[model samples]
Target: MTGTIYSLIPPLIMIILVLLTRKVTLSLGVGIIIGALFIHEFNVMDSIQQIWSAFYGIFVAEGGPNMGTFYLLFFLIFLGMLTAFMSASGGTRAFGEWAITKIQTKKGAQLLPFFLGIIIFIDDYFNSLAIGQVARPLTDRHKISRAKLAYLIDSTSAPVAVLSPISSWGAFIIGTIGAIIAEHNLSNFQPLESFVRMIPMNIYAIIAIFLVFLVVIFKLNLGAMRKHEQRAEETGELVDPNRNDIPGELKEEFVQTNSGRIYHLTIPIVVLIISTIAAMVITGRNNVEENATLLTIFENTNVNLSLFIGGLIAVYHSAIFYLIQMQPKTSTFLVLREGIKSMLPAIYILILAWVIGTIIENLGTGDYLALVVERSQLSPSYLPVIVFIVCGIMAFATGTSWGTFGIMLPIVGQIAVNSDVNMLLASLAAVLAGSVFGDHCSPISDTSILSSTGAGSNHIDHVLTQIPYAVIAAIITIIGYVVLGITGMVWITLILSLVLLFATALILNKLTQS
Candidate 1:
């Protein structure tokens, strides 16, 4: 059943169930079970065993505990505790109070994450989580919906990282491009040079980033996002109160004091940002060969471990600050417990997302999609647009942008080399753009999950609310890719895509308001 039509059923079922029921866990569980059954030829016993193996494999790989998974999970736990500490110690309150005075409007509050997301272009995971922590207080103070905050964080993080040459995503992409170039004997192109060329060609990323600014500046609240924003504005409910499992949400039992200084919030975050970047460089240097370029160092960097180290430092700083600002009758360990509790919902969703992703990989859903593209036998001029759509579908179904990139980039490279070498960079850029777009919209994407967790938004709410905006950007990107494919003009395609996105946003805003 591998790489066949049967492999598509599980993800399709999962996506449809998510749309209908809005139960992420249930949908992922069903998808996992169905995928397992297919893999085992519907033998119940074998299917059950396979499912167990899949779950176990998350924590145990290669005859040992998977330290990478452990690091990332623990990082989330630490981040949750950090959020709790800031709230319990009144850091969040102080920050919110101060922000209200400084940032007088919702638009200004919303733009905090927009700018921060672009500035923190180290890694998408780090950018999403860190920006959420820093901007949530201000956004909440201005009554900004969590869904909108998540959109701002998500839409910028990947786009900025994908375009920056010094980022973690950039390093990995450059390395992959190097391999592809080496294989294809493209001696005229340097990996870094080729990546720079693809920057303008990555239409989805540019258009998506541009749309974030338009949404913030123009208040283009579309689809479910408008409901969330309207509810927040009219009723002061930033999230869906019916959804109790939102991560990073402060519980009522936590103690908050009035004695907190602005530094209580600012210092720990500064420490986190500085420590994480330092750790990334240090860890990256240790793993790279002598005299390796900066990109190579980042390519070899231990991102999960660096994030864990930074989280540990931030938590330690927060704990110290919490003790100093501790009100009477409050226990430090109790605060820690509540903090861990706040993040457990997100952790569970992340684990399930990983499980379903694994099952889908085993079922060969992505491979089937890639194979379909390979066999399409399309004309050269249509390759970029076709690749963009198929890559989007694979990333959407699999909920892993990097996995989609790994699968599609090489295949797209081969297809381009054999058919239209002139269209290679444009085709490759489409893969990057489409992967990010699909990942942005996927319910089960780790980036999406983390963005929701960071903003204290319900995971499904984030997915549902973000889809319309992402789809609009994707549509504009498709048009750009078609133009690029036909004419191979990067500047014209980019300018046209931006114009279309801006016009769409303005039209949507007027229609929604009217």
Candidate 2:
């Protein structure tokens, strides 16, 4: 069952339908039904029952284990509420006005999100949602397309999170590495040290982050993204024309009072950032020694609960600010309602994504993919490249980088330790890099979905426009891994890869213009 090719059918069907119909929800539904049928041996009634059971289990029956899903839903709702409060109180408008005075160019508008994404490297989910919410108003004012904004938010998120030493992603990777070390009985293994060593070797993340700057600095937009930028610039329509029911667009004009100050927006956001970090430190205190390091604190922190507390604090702060400004309590309630309402579509998409990811996991998608890689007969020198490609495909199909890491890391670790293939570190780096790269490109990925939700961008447009850029980075990353595998020269390979990426971007920009 592990290596069965049949396991690929569901994701393939979903991807095809998404590309053809441009309907993510419908595509996921169909994929789920099809997966159910496969799991039940194609018995229609049994498949229907299984699908229903899965829905119930994910949404209701499995409560404690599924707290993460609930946390995300609450986070999104409160985020929407925060956005609405900011907008209705004129905080968003005031901030946009202030930003326009300082930044007065499209590049600045795009670069702001890039820098914010890098700064909020604690978690990709937090990074995507917060950056998108903050930058949407500025990007729209400057006529930068939502798709481009989503690309920036998404590109910065997992890349920065994966690279940061004291972040949720770093902790997760370290844990997985530690498990692999224990399982394989590998001697002298230092998880944190190994992860730090792998940072320079994470070619995809390095290139992805660099590409954001290159695209922003040079205004490089190709394919669907170019058309989107053109439409936004020429017509002042920052939203996708095909889908005009953008979440926050309708509420953009409804300011409760003209007395909104920039502090109204800045204060809550600052509180959110501070509260989240503090909560993380406090929660992890019991788990660590008195002289705990920052990394140790992050490793022991409960990210979901900390994020929930942060969101709650931000919401309360926003509400109090409105009251202090003499805004009616009724008006504040209405704004919160509107904010919650706007997130309904995103919430529905997220639920489906979770269900599908669950289905993929139950179907043993990652194990199947790993089995295929295990069976492949390749040279030892090519192991890193192969592992990278396999892990990327698994993450893209399953729409979860963390899940991919959990399933593939142990397998890859064992393979690397084999007598013939001594590539433990290289393979580990490849798995890490590939997981992030694939999640970056996956339409159904939670981070990707959150990016679109946060940017207030059309989900499919974000996926379509961002894929080409992700593919470009993946190509260069593959070359870098190949060079590393063969020459064992990490620094040299990285330099060459960086040069190649810049050249590729320059050439592609010229071709797009021509």
Candidate 3:
């Protein structure tokens, strides 16, 4: 009993710290110390020992963070580099400039991003950063706030990844849940089918994205976040205080490639999509016993070879440009280095996040948190909402969504099996939805901070501004999940959540006007 009370102290303190100060790095570091102090119950010297032990556990626990972590982290960063290489080669800018010429209206401004989100269905991490970078200058030209642009990029990121069966996220989610079910000896039904069904029912992502479209289309009235949004509308000369004292003409003429051409930019992304799908189909064969590891899919699929060949093709095309005297050696080097350097922030966060996850797992936060849920009357019928809310709070407190999901997924699986519910569907949705919800609200979250940085807004400002919209989506999504519990869920929750939220948004607009 005392142990549990001590365990609860750390996470609770984290919440108060974030609410008061909104500093993500400090919040996360403080939370770790709190967990170390209370949960581990270590003597002062032993606490230091345990903290080092947890960090070691992540980096060297055989197949722990060392093996699995590298695959996703490298995959994402390299994917970013490939996209960067293409932009440097003049692929992305061609598209951006061409769109500026062709799409002259505001409606076109909105649709362009939605289409990009739909088309870039390979990976969420890739989707968020790539689309956000590509669409920024164009949307800024038309007065779209960085927050709105970030929302567009973010909404499309995981939501599209969840729906698309071929992406790496699809592979990880399916593989994780599938393995857990099989471990518990309950692998009777087709898990992929559940994944497919859940796609239509991923209410929060669908609804949030839908609200973005509506907000842009109707030029809706901003409520709580109007100040942040209005900041984007100002045309006054506020110099970027952080810019190095480079000449304006030099910066303008610096040949930003990702925004320049379509072929280089589009080809690599399209190849990535094709390769990811091919990997999924090859590994996910039979759906019931698709025991595909990351290595297996990477080695088996010709499409990855194709992606590599496509990357080679990009290099080869650049070679041709050098022959034509359009390529500069100095410029190409800068782009590659820039691309690698650009992903460092994300990479550092990934490493720290994994370490934190290891700490929580070792300290038995999951078991303690699980005990709370079990005693708290959290029924299966209301599991989605309850789990969603809980996971969100945990993620927000801890500042690590992946870590939150990793802990929650197993507990959710245990509950699902115990309740005789569709464990795969219910548990997976809860983790994904919960992670995103917490990430959306968490000031310390990598994505949350990145979105704010991308928008050039203050991180706390972004969190405060984004919360009302995110909460609206979360609330309506809980209702949609509840509706499923009642009606046996004829349609997908994504569709229902979108419809319900849109109606609520319209009503909000009406109420504000009245």
Clash counts per candidate, in order, are 0, 0, 14
What RMSD value applies to candidate 1? 1.0
Give the residue spans of candidate 3 off by over 4 A. Answer: 1-5, 15-22, 53-94, 172-188, 199-201, 220-225, 236-341, 376-380, 398-410, 413-432, 444-463, 486-499, 511-514
lDDT-wise, the better of 2 and 3 is 2
TM-score of 3: 0.75
Candidate 1's TM-score reads 0.99
lDDT of each residue in 1-514, candidate 2, tens digit only: 2237888888889999999988888999999988887777888998888777777776575444566567768878888888887777778889999999999988999999999998899988889888877788789899998889999999999999999878988988898888888887777778888898888888999999999999998778978999899999999877767885454344543455678899889998988889988988898776887888787788898887788888899989987777777754346667877888888878888888888887787788888889888888777778889999999999999999999888888888887888344578888889988998889878789889988888888888888999999999999999999999899898999999999989987887788768
Give each prediction's root-mean-square deviation over alpha carbons.
1.0, 2.0, 5.6
Model-by-model lDDT, in order?
0.90, 0.85, 0.60
Deviating ranges (above 4 Å) for candidate 1: none
Candidate 3 lDDT over residue span 1-514, tens digit each: 2226455566667657767875545665677676676644656676677678776775666655554445455554454455455555565557667767877765677677777877877655546644654565467566665556566666666667666656656656666667776778875645566667676566776777777777767665365355544654665212222323111001222355332346555555555555555544554442334666553353233433333333344444533432343544336556555555655554554455555555555566555666666667556777777777778776765666667766787777777777856634765686677777777876656566555433334455556667787788789878877876666563765567777877887887787567
Compare the candidates by lDDT and give the number of the best one. Answer: 1
